[model samples]
Target chain A: MKAKIYITLKAGVLDPQGKAVEHSLHNLGFEGVTGVRQGKYMEIELATEDKTKAEADLDEMCKKLLANIVIENYRIELE
Target chain B: MKAKIYITLKAGVLDPQGKAVEHSLHNLGFEGVTGVRQGKYMEIELATEDKTKAEADLDEMCKKLLANIVIENYRIELE
Candidate 1:
């Protein structure tokens, strides 16, 4: 099985790197771009057939280390 | 309009950061996790109704600065 996780800064959080990229994009003539938010994507390959246990473990991983609960949110897609 | 871009190191590329994270996950007791690939996710909010143009511009951004074409691949989702 494969799982893809997306971790991103929460709303109202200050994303300096995202802002910088947005600014650069605008400067590069990308018109109409109003805002940008940057985040992380992690793809994990597992050999298990138990998706329930896998998801549970992955959720725990996200909360414990993959995502900063205080300022970031995460979503997982399993395949 | 909103566009979400997912960028990642291409297959066969050496991803040191991803390997480190995978090792940490294994240490943290995520069983069955065999490999991990890390990437970037960027969300852009645009004020225009032109999806085609936005996608084109975003593709350019990804190729030029948002992603390293030599080692990375990017996908765009428009909404």
Candidate 2:
């Protein structure tokens, strides 16, 4: 099974990297861009074929190592 | 308009960060994880309401600044 995870900063958190990208976009003349937020996208391949098990393991992974829960949020998709 | 961009290393390219993450996961006892690849996810907000124009501009942005086409690939999703 394969898992896709998206980890993003929570609302109200400051994102300097995102600000930098937004500024760069403007400098590159992409003036229509109003905002930019950066996040982490991860692809994980699991040996287990059980969808339920994979989902549980992935959720645990996100909680333990994949995300900074205090300031970020994560969403997972399995295939 | 909103655009979500995922930028990942090309298949043949080496990813040291990904390797490190995999190693850490293994040490952390996520034994079911066979492989891991890390990528960038960006949410971009555009002032323009035209989807076609936004797509074109986003493609240009990716080529010019958001992605290194030589060793990385990017997928854009508009909403």
Best by lDDT: 2
Q: Candidate 1's residue-wise lDDT over B1-79, tens digit each?
A: 9899999999999999999998898888886789999999999998888878887888888988899999999999998
lDDT, model 1, position B40: 98
For residue A48, what is the lDDT in candidate 1?
86
Compute DockQ for each candidate against the true complex. Answer: 0.88, 0.94
Q: Rate the local accuracy (lDDT) of all candidates.
A: 0.91, 0.94
Instruction: Go through the candidates in order and give the C-alpha RMSD of each one to the true structure.
Output: 0.9, 0.6
TM-score of 1: 0.97
Candidate 2 error regions (>4 Å): none
Report the C-alpha lDDT of model 2 over B1-79, residue by residue, as the tens digit: 8999999999978988888888888999988888899999999999999999999999999999999999999999999
Cand. 2 TM to true fold = 0.98
Model 2 lDDT per residue over A2-65, tens place: 8999999999999999999999999999999999999999999999999988898889899999
Q: How well is candidate 1 docked (DockQ)?
A: 0.88
